[model samples]
Target: AQRVTQPEKLLSVFKGAPVELKCNYSYSGSPELFWYVQYSRQRLQLLLRHISRESIKGFTADLNKGETSFHLKKPFAQEEDSAMYYCALINGNEKLTFGTGTRLTIIP
Candidate 1:
């Protein structure tokens, strides 16, 4: 069995501050890691994936297989960036397992 863990349930930061969301996973085999965000009254969308090596909304995450962690980071935080972020993992069976999620609040 695989599981995703997000230790933080809520994160608040002032505008222009850096943001880092912690994510850790446990699985026996290789897994695909991803970060997804959901804004106010909006549907969940993909932020980035380890394999793609791309950055979205100024956010990026790197998969550390040895550490079994994938942490999302942003150089600067903006008000619009406030949202619910979820770290997920795709299992060998193609099933997506998501963490409880973190609510990010960017203050002015």
Candidate 2:
């Protein structure tokens, strides 16, 4: 069974500080990885994808197939960036498995 795990339930940081959200997955076959973010009172939207190799909102995520990990990273955190982030993976069956998610709080 493919599963996505986000070890942290919450991550807090001050403005301008760096941020990193850890994510690990277990899957037998090749999986498509993505990071989704939901800001306050907003619907969830895609942040980045492993295949895109592009950064969005100053955030980037790299897929490490060997380690079965896709961690989200940002050099500087912003108050507006605070939100709930979920790591997801699409299995061979095209079913998306999402992590428990992490609530990011940025202190101004």
Residue pairs whose backbone atoms clash in candidate 2? none
Task: Mark the 10 consecutive residues where model 2 has the least summed lDDT.
Answer: 88-97
lDDT of 1 by residue, 1-108 (tens): 899999999999999999999999999998899999999999999889999999998999999988999999999999999999999999878899999999999999
RMSD of each: 0.7, 0.7
Question: Per-residue lDDT for 1-108 in model 2, tens only?
Answer: 889999999999999999999999999888899999999999999999899999999999999999999999999999999999999999767788999999999999
TM-score of 1: 0.97
lDDT of 1 at 34: 94
Candidate 2 lDDT for residue 30: 84
Cα lDDT, all candidates:
0.95, 0.95
TM-score for predicted model 2 compared with the true structure: 0.97
